[model samples]
Target: MPPRAIICPHCGKIIAGDESACSWCGTARSHPWWRLLKPTRDTARTDWVAPALLAANVVFFAVSLILNFVSHSGSILTPGNNVLLLLGASGTIPIDRYGRIWSLVSANYLHGGVLHLLFNMLALRQIGPWVVREFGASRMFVIYTVGGVFGYWVSYVAGVPLTVGASASLCGLIGALLYFGKNRGGNYGNAVYREVSGWVMSIFIFGIIVPGVNNWGHGGGLVGGIAMGMLLGYNEKRKETPVHRALALACGVITVAVLLRALYGVFPG
Candidate 1:
Protein backbone atom coordinates (compact mmCIF):
# COMPACT_ATOMS: atom_id res chain seq x y z
CA MET A 1 0.00 0.00 0.00
CA PRO A 2 1.16 3.54 -0.73
CA PRO A 3 1.80 5.91 2.19
CA ARG A 4 -0.49 8.90 2.76
CA ALA A 5 1.33 12.17 2.19
CA ILE A 6 0.91 15.73 3.52
CA ILE A 7 2.94 18.94 3.20
CA CYS A 8 4.89 20.26 6.15
CA PRO A 9 3.64 23.73 7.06
CA HIS A 10 7.05 24.96 8.26
CA CYS A 11 9.51 23.58 5.71
CA GLY A 12 6.94 23.07 2.93
CA LYS A 13 8.11 19.58 1.98
CA ILE A 14 5.79 16.63 1.63
CA ILE A 15 5.97 14.07 4.40
CA ALA A 16 4.22 10.93 5.55
CA GLY A 17 0.86 11.89 7.03
CA ASP A 18 1.30 9.60 10.03
CA GLU A 19 4.28 11.50 11.41
CA SER A 20 3.66 13.83 14.39
CA ALA A 21 6.57 16.17 13.53
CA CYS A 22 7.68 17.16 10.08
CA SER A 23 10.68 15.00 9.24
CA TRP A 24 12.05 17.80 7.07
CA CYS A 25 12.12 20.62 9.64
CA GLY A 26 10.71 19.01 12.80
CA THR A 27 7.81 21.47 12.82
CA ALA A 28 4.47 20.20 14.06
CA ARG A 29 2.13 19.48 11.17
CA SER A 30 -0.93 20.99 12.84
CA HIS A 31 -0.44 24.71 12.63
CA PRO A 32 -3.28 27.26 12.72
CA TRP A 33 -2.05 29.90 10.26
CA TRP A 34 -3.60 28.17 7.28
CA ARG A 35 -7.02 29.29 8.38
CA LEU A 36 -5.89 32.90 8.33
CA LEU A 37 -4.77 32.65 4.70
CA LYS A 38 -7.62 31.70 2.41
CA PRO A 39 -5.67 32.56 -0.72
CA THR A 40 -6.88 31.96 -4.27
CA ARG A 41 -6.01 28.96 -6.39
CA ASP A 42 -2.33 28.91 -7.47
CA THR A 43 -1.34 25.74 -9.34
CA ALA A 44 0.64 27.22 -12.22
CA ARG A 45 4.43 27.32 -12.29
CA THR A 46 5.67 30.93 -11.74
CA ASP A 47 8.42 31.35 -14.33
CA TRP A 48 6.88 34.58 -15.70
CA VAL A 49 7.28 36.60 -12.53
CA ALA A 50 10.92 37.66 -13.02
CA PRO A 51 10.57 38.47 -16.71
CA ALA A 52 7.46 40.51 -16.03
CA LEU A 53 9.30 42.59 -13.45
CA LEU A 54 12.21 43.14 -15.79
CA ALA A 55 9.84 44.20 -18.55
CA ALA A 56 8.05 46.62 -16.27
CA ASN A 57 11.31 48.30 -15.27
CA VAL A 58 12.47 48.69 -18.86
CA VAL A 59 9.12 49.97 -20.08
CA PHE A 60 8.94 52.50 -17.30
CA PHE A 61 12.42 53.77 -18.15
CA ALA A 62 11.43 54.18 -21.80
CA VAL A 63 8.30 56.04 -20.79
CA SER A 64 10.31 58.29 -18.51
CA LEU A 65 12.61 59.17 -21.39
CA ILE A 66 9.71 59.96 -23.68
CA LEU A 67 8.17 62.23 -21.11
CA ASN A 68 11.47 63.99 -20.48
CA PHE A 69 11.98 64.58 -24.19
CA VAL A 70 8.45 65.82 -24.66
CA SER A 71 8.75 68.20 -21.74
CA HIS A 72 12.25 69.35 -22.79
CA SER A 73 13.75 68.51 -19.46
CA GLY A 74 16.35 65.91 -18.49
CA SER A 75 18.63 64.56 -21.26
CA ILE A 76 17.87 61.42 -23.26
CA LEU A 77 20.03 59.30 -21.01
CA THR A 78 18.76 60.83 -17.76
CA PRO A 79 15.14 61.72 -17.13
CA GLY A 80 14.41 64.93 -15.24
CA ASN A 81 13.22 64.91 -11.66
CA ASN A 82 9.89 66.25 -12.91
CA VAL A 83 9.46 63.30 -15.23
CA LEU A 84 10.38 60.84 -12.48
CA LEU A 85 8.02 62.55 -10.09
CA LEU A 86 5.31 62.27 -12.72
CA LEU A 87 6.10 58.55 -13.01
CA GLY A 88 5.73 58.18 -9.22
CA ALA A 89 9.28 58.50 -7.90
CA SER A 90 8.94 58.04 -4.16
CA GLY A 91 10.46 59.74 -1.13
CA THR A 92 9.60 62.69 1.10
CA ILE A 93 8.81 64.95 -1.88
CA PRO A 94 6.15 62.73 -3.47
CA ILE A 95 4.94 61.35 -0.20
CA ASP A 96 4.63 64.59 1.68
CA ARG A 97 4.13 67.29 -0.96
CA TYR A 98 1.88 65.39 -3.37
CA GLY A 99 0.39 62.92 -0.89
CA ARG A 100 1.15 59.96 -3.18
CA ILE A 101 2.27 57.39 -0.70
CA TRP A 102 1.55 54.75 -3.30
CA SER A 103 4.50 56.07 -5.28
CA LEU A 104 6.54 53.72 -3.16
CA VAL A 105 5.48 50.92 -5.47
CA SER A 106 5.73 52.83 -8.74
CA ALA A 107 9.15 54.21 -7.96
CA ASN A 108 10.55 50.70 -8.02
CA TYR A 109 10.06 50.75 -11.79
CA LEU A 110 11.52 54.22 -12.43
CA HIS A 111 15.17 55.14 -12.91
CA GLY A 112 17.28 58.28 -13.29
CA GLY A 113 19.40 57.28 -16.29
CA VAL A 114 20.02 54.56 -18.87
CA LEU A 115 23.00 53.35 -16.91
CA HIS A 116 20.89 53.36 -13.78
CA LEU A 117 18.29 51.18 -15.45
CA LEU A 118 20.96 48.97 -17.00
CA PHE A 119 22.84 48.34 -13.77
CA ASN A 120 19.73 47.73 -11.70
CA MET A 121 18.25 45.43 -14.34
CA LEU A 122 21.48 43.48 -14.62
CA ALA A 123 21.54 43.02 -10.85
CA LEU A 124 17.92 41.95 -10.90
CA ARG A 125 18.58 39.55 -13.75
CA GLN A 126 21.31 37.88 -11.74
CA ILE A 127 19.66 37.85 -8.31
CA GLY A 128 16.07 37.32 -9.39
CA PRO A 129 16.77 33.80 -10.68
CA TRP A 130 18.73 32.83 -7.60
CA VAL A 131 15.87 34.00 -5.42
CA VAL A 132 13.33 32.19 -7.55
CA ARG A 133 15.36 28.99 -7.31
CA GLU A 134 15.81 29.26 -3.56
CA PHE A 135 12.60 30.98 -2.43
CA GLY A 136 10.29 30.00 -5.27
CA ALA A 137 9.01 32.59 -7.76
CA SER A 138 6.01 33.70 -5.75
CA ARG A 139 7.99 34.26 -2.59
CA MET A 140 10.70 35.94 -4.63
CA PHE A 141 8.24 38.48 -6.04
CA VAL A 142 6.76 39.13 -2.65
CA ILE A 143 10.23 39.73 -1.25
CA TYR A 144 11.20 42.02 -4.12
CA THR A 145 8.06 44.16 -4.03
CA VAL A 146 7.90 44.48 -0.28
CA GLY A 147 11.62 45.09 -0.04
CA GLY A 148 11.37 48.08 -2.36
CA VAL A 149 8.53 49.58 -0.37
CA PHE A 150 10.23 49.03 2.96
CA GLY A 151 13.52 50.41 1.70
CA TYR A 152 11.85 53.58 0.43
CA TRP A 153 9.94 53.89 3.65
CA VAL A 154 13.22 53.87 5.49
CA SER A 155 14.61 56.58 3.23
CA TYR A 156 11.47 58.64 3.74
CA VAL A 157 11.87 58.34 7.49
CA ALA A 158 15.43 59.50 7.09
CA GLY A 159 14.14 62.55 5.15
CA VAL A 160 15.49 61.83 1.67
CA PRO A 161 13.81 64.31 -0.65
CA LEU A 162 13.63 62.21 -3.81
CA THR A 163 14.61 58.70 -5.02
CA VAL A 164 13.97 56.31 -7.89
CA GLY A 165 15.49 52.99 -8.98
CA ALA A 166 15.39 49.21 -8.41
CA SER A 167 18.60 49.09 -6.37
CA ALA A 168 16.71 49.02 -3.10
CA SER A 169 14.69 46.03 -4.28
CA LEU A 170 17.88 44.45 -5.62
CA CYS A 171 19.39 44.80 -2.19
CA GLY A 172 16.40 42.97 -0.81
CA LEU A 173 17.14 39.99 -3.07
CA ILE A 174 20.76 40.06 -1.95
CA GLY A 175 19.75 40.11 1.71
CA ALA A 176 17.42 37.16 1.21
CA LEU A 177 20.14 35.15 -0.57
CA LEU A 178 22.57 36.07 2.19
CA TYR A 179 20.18 34.77 4.80
CA PHE A 180 19.55 31.64 2.75
CA GLY A 181 23.27 30.97 2.43
CA LYS A 182 24.02 31.46 6.09
CA ASN A 183 20.98 29.55 7.25
CA ARG A 184 21.56 26.63 4.90
CA GLY A 185 25.22 26.39 6.09
CA GLY A 186 26.92 24.06 3.60
CA ASN A 187 29.40 24.36 0.74
CA TYR A 188 26.78 25.88 -1.52
CA GLY A 189 25.51 28.05 1.31
CA ASN A 190 28.98 29.35 2.06
CA ALA A 191 29.51 30.13 -1.58
CA VAL A 192 26.26 32.12 -1.78
CA TYR A 193 27.18 33.96 1.40
CA ARG A 194 30.60 34.94 0.11
CA GLU A 195 29.30 36.15 -3.24
CA VAL A 196 26.44 38.11 -1.65
CA SER A 197 28.82 39.57 0.90
CA GLY A 198 30.92 40.91 -1.94
CA TRP A 199 27.84 42.60 -3.36
CA VAL A 200 27.09 44.13 0.02
CA MET A 201 30.61 45.49 0.33
CA SER A 202 30.60 46.90 -3.18
CA ILE A 203 27.25 48.58 -2.68
CA PHE A 204 28.50 50.06 0.58
CA ILE A 205 31.58 51.43 -1.13
CA PHE A 206 29.58 52.77 -4.04
CA GLY A 207 27.12 54.46 -1.70
CA ILE A 208 30.06 56.04 0.07
CA ILE A 209 31.74 57.32 -3.09
CA VAL A 210 28.65 58.15 -5.10
CA PRO A 211 27.25 61.38 -3.76
CA GLY A 212 23.71 60.76 -5.01
CA VAL A 213 23.27 57.17 -3.90
CA ASN A 214 20.46 56.49 -1.44
CA ASN A 215 22.36 54.53 1.18
CA TRP A 216 19.34 54.63 3.43
CA GLY A 217 17.29 52.75 0.84
CA HIS A 218 20.03 50.17 0.37
CA GLY A 219 20.43 49.60 4.10
CA GLY A 220 16.69 49.47 4.64
CA GLY A 221 16.22 47.00 1.81
CA LEU A 222 18.84 44.73 3.29
CA VAL A 223 17.16 44.81 6.68
CA GLY A 224 13.73 44.26 5.21
CA GLY A 225 14.94 41.39 3.00
CA ILE A 226 16.47 39.55 5.92
CA ALA A 227 13.26 39.92 7.91
CA MET A 228 11.09 38.69 5.05
CA GLY A 229 13.41 35.75 4.30
CA MET A 230 13.18 34.59 7.89
CA LEU A 231 9.44 35.05 8.01
CA LEU A 232 8.67 33.46 4.62
CA GLY A 233 11.15 30.56 4.88
CA TYR A 234 12.51 29.01 1.67
CA ASN A 235 12.21 26.13 -0.84
CA GLU A 236 14.42 23.63 1.01
CA LYS A 237 12.47 24.32 4.18
CA ARG A 238 9.14 25.16 2.55
CA LYS A 239 7.71 24.79 -0.94
CA GLU A 240 5.83 27.57 -2.64
CA THR A 241 2.27 27.55 -1.34
CA PRO A 242 -1.02 29.11 -2.41
CA VAL A 243 -0.51 31.87 0.13
CA HIS A 244 2.81 32.87 -1.41
CA ARG A 245 1.28 32.87 -4.87
CA ALA A 246 -1.65 34.93 -3.71
CA LEU A 247 0.61 37.48 -2.05
CA ALA A 248 2.70 37.81 -5.17
CA LEU A 249 -0.44 38.33 -7.24
CA ALA A 250 -1.65 40.93 -4.82
CA CYS A 251 1.67 42.74 -5.09
CA GLY A 252 1.41 42.63 -8.87
CA VAL A 253 -2.12 43.97 -8.82
CA ILE A 254 -1.15 46.80 -6.51
CA THR A 255 1.87 47.66 -8.65
CA VAL A 256 -0.23 47.81 -11.82
CA ALA A 257 -2.88 49.95 -10.17
CA VAL A 258 -0.28 52.42 -8.91
CA LEU A 259 1.43 52.65 -12.28
CA LEU A 260 -1.87 53.26 -13.98
CA ARG A 261 -2.70 55.96 -11.50
CA ALA A 262 0.67 57.59 -12.15
CA LEU A 263 0.14 57.45 -15.89
CA TYR A 264 -3.33 58.87 -15.49
CA GLY A 265 -1.76 61.78 -13.73
CA VAL A 266 0.57 62.23 -16.69
CA PHE A 267 -1.94 61.83 -19.54
CA PRO A 268 -5.23 62.48 -17.87
CA GLY A 269 -8.21 63.24 -20.09
Candidate 2:
Protein backbone atom coordinates (compact mmCIF):
# COMPACT_ATOMS: atom_id res chain seq x y z
CA MET A 1 0.00 0.00 0.00
CA PRO A 2 1.10 3.63 -0.75
CA PRO A 3 2.22 5.76 2.20
CA ARG A 4 -0.09 8.53 3.38
CA ALA A 5 0.79 12.14 2.31
CA ILE A 6 1.24 15.38 4.28
CA ILE A 7 0.83 19.00 3.19
CA CYS A 8 3.71 21.52 3.21
CA PRO A 9 3.45 24.42 5.65
CA HIS A 10 4.78 27.24 3.42
CA CYS A 11 3.14 26.19 0.17
CA GLY A 12 0.14 23.89 0.25
CA LYS A 13 1.17 20.72 -1.49
CA ILE A 14 0.89 17.07 -0.57
CA ILE A 15 3.84 14.74 -0.47
CA ALA A 16 4.47 11.20 0.69
CA GLY A 17 5.88 10.84 4.20
CA ASP A 18 9.36 10.01 2.93
CA GLU A 19 9.34 12.54 0.05
CA SER A 20 11.19 15.85 0.50
CA ALA A 21 9.04 17.87 -1.88
CA CYS A 22 5.53 18.06 -3.37
CA SER A 23 5.14 16.24 -6.66
CA TRP A 24 2.43 18.64 -7.83
CA CYS A 25 3.93 22.10 -7.09
CA GLY A 26 7.54 21.41 -6.09
CA THR A 27 7.08 22.93 -2.64
CA ALA A 28 9.52 21.57 -0.15
CA ARG A 29 7.92 19.55 2.67
CA SER A 30 9.14 21.34 5.76
CA HIS A 31 9.32 18.35 8.00
CA PRO A 32 12.59 17.21 9.59
CA TRP A 33 13.64 15.79 6.24
CA TRP A 34 13.14 19.09 4.34
CA ARG A 35 14.98 20.99 7.10
CA LEU A 36 18.12 19.17 6.13
CA LEU A 37 17.98 20.47 2.52
CA LYS A 38 19.27 23.78 1.22
CA PRO A 39 16.95 26.55 0.01
CA THR A 40 16.97 27.85 -3.52
CA ARG A 41 15.04 30.25 -5.73
CA ASP A 42 14.90 31.23 -9.40
CA THR A 43 15.85 34.87 -9.78
CA ALA A 44 16.77 37.02 -12.76
CA ARG A 45 20.38 38.06 -13.02
CA THR A 46 21.19 41.75 -13.36
CA ASP A 47 22.48 43.14 -16.64
CA TRP A 48 26.12 44.09 -17.35
CA VAL A 49 25.56 47.71 -18.47
CA ALA A 50 26.55 49.27 -15.16
CA PRO A 51 29.92 47.52 -14.87
CA ALA A 52 30.68 48.36 -18.49
CA LEU A 53 29.97 52.02 -17.84
CA LEU A 54 32.30 52.03 -14.86
CA ALA A 55 35.04 50.41 -16.90
CA ALA A 56 34.65 53.05 -19.60
CA ASN A 57 35.08 55.81 -17.05
CA VAL A 58 38.26 54.19 -15.71
CA VAL A 59 39.69 53.76 -19.19
CA PHE A 60 38.96 57.39 -20.03
CA PHE A 61 40.81 58.56 -16.93
CA ALA A 62 43.85 56.41 -17.75
CA VAL A 63 43.96 57.62 -21.35
CA SER A 64 43.55 61.22 -20.24
CA LEU A 65 46.52 60.87 -17.89
CA ILE A 66 48.70 59.46 -20.65
CA LEU A 67 47.66 62.20 -23.07
CA ASN A 68 48.32 64.87 -20.48
CA PHE A 69 51.85 63.56 -19.98
CA VAL A 70 52.62 63.42 -23.69
CA SER A 71 51.06 66.79 -24.45
CA HIS A 72 52.27 69.22 -21.75
CA SER A 73 54.77 67.19 -19.69
CA GLY A 74 52.21 67.33 -16.91
CA SER A 75 50.82 64.13 -15.45
CA ILE A 76 47.24 65.42 -16.02
CA LEU A 77 45.62 67.45 -18.73
CA THR A 78 44.62 71.07 -18.18
CA PRO A 79 43.37 73.57 -20.71
CA GLY A 80 46.09 75.94 -21.89
CA ASN A 81 45.27 79.61 -21.56
CA ASN A 82 45.18 79.88 -25.37
CA VAL A 83 42.67 77.00 -25.75
CA LEU A 84 40.76 77.45 -22.50
CA LEU A 85 37.94 79.28 -24.18
CA LEU A 86 37.70 76.73 -26.94
CA LEU A 87 37.80 73.79 -24.57
CA GLY A 88 34.84 74.95 -22.41
CA ALA A 89 37.11 75.03 -19.35
CA SER A 90 36.98 78.85 -18.98
CA GLY A 91 33.34 78.78 -17.70
CA THR A 92 32.42 81.71 -19.97
CA ILE A 93 31.44 82.05 -23.57
CA PRO A 94 33.83 84.04 -25.73
CA ILE A 95 32.14 87.16 -26.94
CA ASP A 96 31.42 86.90 -30.70
CA ARG A 97 33.80 83.89 -30.88
CA TYR A 98 32.69 80.42 -31.78
CA GLY A 99 34.11 77.24 -30.31
CA ARG A 100 33.09 73.61 -30.04
CA ILE A 101 29.83 73.48 -28.19
CA TRP A 102 30.46 69.76 -27.94
CA SER A 103 33.10 70.39 -25.27
CA LEU A 104 30.28 70.30 -22.77
CA VAL A 105 29.82 66.67 -23.72
CA SER A 106 33.57 65.94 -23.72
CA ALA A 107 34.25 67.58 -20.38
CA ASN A 108 32.17 64.93 -18.63
CA TYR A 109 35.07 62.46 -18.92
CA LEU A 110 37.81 64.73 -17.52
CA HIS A 111 38.72 64.92 -13.83
CA GLY A 112 41.04 67.24 -11.91
CA GLY A 113 42.68 64.94 -9.34
CA VAL A 114 42.76 61.52 -7.71
CA LEU A 115 40.15 62.47 -5.12
CA HIS A 116 37.86 63.78 -7.81
CA LEU A 117 38.06 60.58 -9.80
CA LEU A 118 37.69 58.44 -6.70
CA PHE A 119 34.55 60.15 -5.43
CA ASN A 120 32.83 60.16 -8.81
CA MET A 121 33.69 56.55 -9.58
CA LEU A 122 32.62 55.43 -6.12
CA ALA A 123 29.27 57.12 -6.54
CA LEU A 124 28.89 55.54 -9.97
CA ARG A 125 29.62 52.09 -8.62
CA GLN A 126 27.08 52.51 -5.86
CA ILE A 127 24.18 53.97 -7.87
CA GLY A 128 24.85 52.96 -11.47
CA PRO A 129 23.81 49.32 -11.30
CA TRP A 130 20.41 50.20 -9.95
CA VAL A 131 19.80 52.73 -12.68
CA VAL A 132 20.82 50.27 -15.38
CA ARG A 133 18.63 47.53 -13.97
CA GLU A 134 15.65 49.80 -13.58
CA PHE A 135 15.93 51.79 -16.78
CA GLY A 136 18.34 49.71 -18.86
CA ALA A 137 21.86 50.86 -19.80
CA SER A 138 21.18 53.07 -22.81
CA ARG A 139 18.81 55.40 -21.00
CA MET A 140 21.24 55.63 -18.11
CA PHE A 141 24.01 56.72 -20.48
CA VAL A 142 21.81 59.41 -21.99
CA ILE A 143 20.94 60.71 -18.56
CA TYR A 144 24.61 60.74 -17.55
CA THR A 145 26.03 62.49 -20.61
CA VAL A 146 23.26 65.02 -21.08
CA GLY A 147 23.02 65.64 -17.37
CA GLY A 148 26.74 66.36 -17.10
CA VAL A 149 26.65 68.75 -20.01
CA PHE A 150 23.69 70.59 -18.55
CA GLY A 151 25.31 70.78 -15.14
CA TYR A 152 28.57 72.17 -16.51
CA TRP A 153 26.68 74.72 -18.58
CA VAL A 154 24.93 75.95 -15.46
CA SER A 155 28.26 76.36 -13.67
CA TYR A 156 29.69 78.24 -16.62
CA VAL A 157 26.68 80.54 -16.74
CA ALA A 158 27.14 81.17 -13.02
CA GLY A 159 30.79 82.23 -13.58
CA VAL A 160 32.52 79.29 -11.92
CA PRO A 161 35.77 78.87 -13.76
CA LEU A 162 37.91 75.96 -14.99
CA THR A 163 35.96 72.93 -13.74
CA VAL A 164 36.37 69.33 -14.91
CA GLY A 165 35.14 65.99 -13.57
CA ALA A 166 32.48 63.27 -13.74
CA SER A 167 30.82 64.37 -10.48
CA ALA A 168 28.09 66.18 -12.34
CA SER A 169 27.33 63.07 -14.38
CA LEU A 170 27.37 60.85 -11.33
CA CYS A 171 24.99 63.23 -9.61
CA GLY A 172 22.67 62.79 -12.55
CA LEU A 173 22.65 59.05 -12.01
CA ILE A 174 21.62 59.58 -8.41
CA GLY A 175 18.87 61.91 -9.51
CA ALA A 176 17.52 59.38 -11.96
CA LEU A 177 17.47 56.73 -9.31
CA LEU A 178 15.64 59.06 -6.96
CA TYR A 179 13.03 59.79 -9.57
CA PHE A 180 12.62 56.12 -10.39
CA GLY A 181 12.15 55.15 -6.78
CA LYS A 182 9.64 57.92 -6.16
CA ASN A 183 7.60 57.31 -9.28
CA ARG A 184 7.21 53.65 -8.52
CA GLY A 185 5.17 54.58 -5.41
CA GLY A 186 5.51 51.77 -2.88
CA ASN A 187 7.18 51.18 0.46
CA TYR A 188 10.29 49.79 -1.17
CA GLY A 189 10.46 52.57 -3.76
CA ASN A 190 9.74 55.38 -1.29
CA ALA A 191 12.33 54.11 1.10
CA VAL A 192 14.98 54.05 -1.60
CA TYR A 193 13.99 57.50 -2.81
CA ARG A 194 14.21 58.97 0.66
CA GLU A 195 17.61 57.44 1.27
CA VAL A 196 19.01 58.78 -1.98
CA SER A 197 17.47 62.18 -1.37
CA GLY A 198 19.21 62.32 1.97
CA TRP A 199 22.51 61.55 0.29
CA VAL A 200 21.91 64.35 -2.19
CA MET A 201 21.10 66.80 0.57
CA SER A 202 24.14 65.80 2.58
CA ILE A 203 26.37 66.31 -0.43
CA PHE A 204 24.91 69.75 -0.96
CA ILE A 205 25.48 70.66 2.67
CA PHE A 206 29.05 69.45 2.46
CA GLY A 207 29.61 71.45 -0.68
CA ILE A 208 28.36 74.54 1.08
CA ILE A 209 30.77 74.02 3.94
CA VAL A 210 33.75 73.19 1.73
CA PRO A 211 35.58 75.62 -0.47
CA GLY A 212 36.09 74.90 -4.22
CA VAL A 213 33.01 72.71 -4.45
CA ASN A 214 30.73 73.52 -7.38
CA ASN A 215 27.21 73.31 -6.05
CA TRP A 216 25.79 74.66 -9.28
CA GLY A 217 27.05 71.70 -11.27
CA HIS A 218 25.59 69.30 -8.75
CA GLY A 219 22.20 70.98 -8.79
CA GLY A 220 22.10 71.15 -12.55
CA GLY A 221 23.04 67.48 -12.94
CA LEU A 222 20.32 66.46 -10.51
CA VAL A 223 17.69 68.46 -12.32
CA GLY A 224 18.81 67.04 -15.62
CA GLY A 225 18.61 63.51 -14.27
CA ILE A 226 15.12 64.00 -12.95
CA ALA A 227 13.96 65.41 -16.25
CA MET A 228 15.50 62.58 -18.19
CA GLY A 229 14.03 60.01 -15.86
CA MET A 230 10.57 61.40 -16.42
CA LEU A 231 11.09 61.20 -20.14
CA LEU A 232 12.67 57.74 -20.26
CA GLY A 233 10.78 56.10 -17.39
CA TYR A 234 11.64 53.21 -15.06
CA ASN A 235 11.71 49.58 -16.30
CA GLU A 236 8.08 49.23 -15.31
CA LYS A 237 7.08 51.42 -18.23
CA ARG A 238 9.11 49.74 -20.96
CA LYS A 239 11.24 46.72 -21.64
CA GLU A 240 14.93 46.93 -22.53
CA THR A 241 14.82 48.09 -26.12
CA PRO A 242 17.29 48.60 -28.96
CA VAL A 243 17.11 52.33 -28.35
CA HIS A 244 18.91 51.78 -25.05
CA ARG A 245 21.76 49.95 -26.73
CA ALA A 246 22.09 52.56 -29.47
CA LEU A 247 22.24 55.47 -27.08
CA ALA A 248 24.89 53.74 -24.99
CA LEU A 249 26.98 53.07 -28.07
CA ALA A 250 26.63 56.65 -29.26
CA CYS A 251 27.75 58.03 -25.92
CA GLY A 252 30.78 55.74 -25.95
CA VAL A 253 31.81 56.81 -29.44
CA ILE A 254 31.40 60.44 -28.57
CA THR A 255 33.56 60.04 -25.49
CA VAL A 256 36.34 58.35 -27.49
CA ALA A 257 36.21 60.97 -30.26
CA VAL A 258 36.43 63.82 -27.76
CA LEU A 259 39.47 62.32 -26.06
CA LEU A 260 41.20 61.86 -29.40
CA ARG A 261 40.52 65.47 -30.35
CA ALA A 262 41.81 66.75 -27.02
CA LEU A 263 45.01 64.69 -27.40
CA TYR A 264 45.65 65.95 -30.91
CA GLY A 265 44.98 69.56 -29.95
CA VAL A 266 47.34 69.42 -27.01
CA PHE A 267 50.20 67.39 -28.56
CA PRO A 268 49.96 68.88 -32.09
CA GLY A 269 52.79 66.78 -33.60
Task: List the candidate 2 regions with Cα displacement exceeding 4 Å.
Answer: 1-47, 63-90, 93-98
Residue 131 local lDDT, model 1: 83
Worst 10 residues of 1 by lDDT: 35-44
lDDT of 2 by residue, 138-166 (tens): 78888888788889888777877566677
lDDT of 1: 0.84
Error of 1 at 186 (Å): 0.9
Model 1, residue pairs in steric clash = 11-237, 11-238
- When summed lDDT is taken over every stretch of 10 residues in candidate 2, the lowest stretch is 35-44
| RMSD (Å) of each candidate, 1 decimal | 8.9, 8.3
* Error at 124, model 1, angstroms: 0.8
**What TM-score, over all chains together, does every model reach?**
0.83, 0.72
Could you say which candidate leads in lDDT? 1
Q: What overall lDDT goes with each candidate model?
A: 0.84, 0.68
